[model samples]
Target: MRKTALLIAAAALLGSVSAQAAEQAIHIDRQPWSFAGPFGTYDRAQLQRGYRVYKEVCSTCHSMKLVAFRNLAQPGGPGFTEAQAKTVAAEYKINDGPNDKGEMFERAGRVTDYFPSPDPNEQAARARFNGSLPPDLSVIAKARGVESGVLRGILNMFTQYQEGGPDYIYAYLTGYGKPPAGEELTPTQHWNSVFPGHKTQMPPPLTDGQVEYTDGTPATVSQYARDVSAFLMWAAEPHLEARKRIGFQVMIFLIVLAGLAYYTKKKVWADLH
Candidate 1:
């Protein structure tokens, strides 16, 4: 009875959350992603490309302070070799403490360093973006996206359609264009179909051939958006693949244990009869 009551309470909470999400009435187009199922894994090559997109383009404005340079060389990530990661780290300059002079100095980034922000503080960031502060990319992918409705959430519990973050990112990136016939945008605002207000302060950030791709992939706007979105998703959840792997193992164990318990119960009851 206690378990049943807990289940009912959970259902009610989920229903409220789902209803709230529906009331917002936002539309986010779904996209195909490599990591979308029980056995889903990050595509190393894709992650590398996504990193390139972020480094060449997104890093100019957004900071990923939570991620370390060494993460690039870690397993289940962008798959950069340690040497490559070190080389990439060296490309950026980081501020370090005084060397006996009580003065700060700039030096090449180390693997332990976090990605630097373009501005020194929020005031500077707002000044750069016309009074709007740029959000951190550390967990933007996970931060975006809507909750699934009650019915869809239940289905997702089984099917694992957990591409909401990447899908929303892709859609938002590609969702920019001119506003409708009568719609007017403020001077600092740009039209975005997927943005909550249909207008956002940030302008469209990508274009065809905006970032040169070393991997021979076409540098289309859509491609850049998708790649960077995937990269950001990985940044937000570096252990996603491992988590899914462990989850599957646990599920299998539970199923096997349940089967064994059923058979054992039958055997004990049979002897009694």
Candidate 2:
């Protein structure tokens, strides 16, 4: 009787675990990013469009505190000219240190200045968002990722699939919609199919025809999401291209060295035999 009772309890526990897993299962489709494989690099035009989307929409709440204006003109980035970067910087009013009068002052932003936060501080940000603080977007692409199951994780290891972050971001941006039947959300909560809990404090941030693209890209919510996600990836790893190049070179060198070592060993063994 005791053994039967233990078995029943174990079955119930397994059932509960399975139910929770089903509730939390979020399927995020992989996106075909320009910077996906070993030899891949970021697309300049796409990054530029992504920046536009962020500036016009995401920047209103999210702060990119780690990015400097000069980075926009750097190699392997959004392809802005130095003058253009300077112009972009000048549009922002940066808070400066105390002047000779020991009073805090505002000044035109310089290329060296990092992008300022949308809110002055954490308290202000929380107050603006109904007690939910907006996350800094500087490295959000690197910070957030989806879990690939055991089989998919093994495949990703072999295929060099390092795009989980961008895939999650893209899925999340496009996942907002009405809650499923029987799933109720409060006014402060929005439904996102890709979000971990299927609910988020952030509402639908993008709409159709929201940001203008001079490059003739479609002004749709999906396009905006793709662009901004790509831009965030670039921000998280500005040196990705260079890193890949160096890794490739090292692999080639190792291959050549291995071949030489094998031939030399065979020659030495042949003479001894």
Candidate 3:
């Protein structure tokens, strides 16, 4: 009986594992990003287009609370001029408080102010979305990532493939579609091929020709997804280019130091030998 029980437990555990594997069997194809690889840098034009997408669409629900307007004008970023950033900041109204009247007041946003949330508070946001709080997009590209299979993971280690987060974002953005036959979804839930459990509270956020692009870039859903994904990546790591440059410099310095140390060691041991 004990042996029989063990067998049953083993079978149950195996079944659970199989179920989990099936649930996690999502496949997301990797995308080529401008800021990928050790020596790669961000494309300024792409970043700018991405910012437009985020501002026009994603910002309606998601907040980028960690990013300040001044960041838009920083070096190694979207390449916006300080005046342009300031102008953009002034377009938004910020809530400030406690003047002589001891009451809250609304004022034009400043360069230092972070992006405002669409809802006033967490509770308000949850209530507005029927208990689903829209996530902040500040570091979303860093927070979300996809797993490569064992073989690909091993290869990624050598290739320095750290764009999984952006790839997942891009896939998720484009993964929306009609549910498969016999699949039931709640009124609020939507189908997403890349999302876990194939259901998401957020509906398809993009449509073809929804956001206009002035620089001759296509205004399609795919283009919007790619642009916004890249922008989110930049928002998550504003100093990525600088970090890569410094890392490369440090590597060269280490190589030269290693060579010098080898020669020094040989010289120091010559007489002893």
User: lDDT, candidate 1, residue 256?
Assistant: 100
**lDDT per residue as tens, model 1, 146-176:** 5566777799778878788888889888999
TM-score of 3: 0.90
Candidate 2 or 1, higher TM-score: 2
Candidate 3 residue-wise lDDT, 131-210, digit = tens: 99899999999998887666677999999999989999999999999999999999999999999889999989999998
Predicted structure 1, TM vs. truth: 0.88
**Global lDDT of each candidate:** 0.88, 0.92, 0.92
State, as a TM-score between 0 and 1, how close model 2 is to the true structure: 0.90
Please give the lDDT score at residue 171 for candidate 2.
Answer: 95
lDDT of 2 by residue, 1-273 (tens): 999999999999988876776665578898999998999999999999999999989989999999999999999899999999999999999999899899999999999999988999999999999999989998999999988665677999999999889999999999998998999898999999889888899999999998988888889999999999999999999999889989999999999999999999999899884
Error of 3 at 271 (Å): 3.0
Error of 1 at 117 (Å): 1.3
lDDT of model 3 at position 257: 100
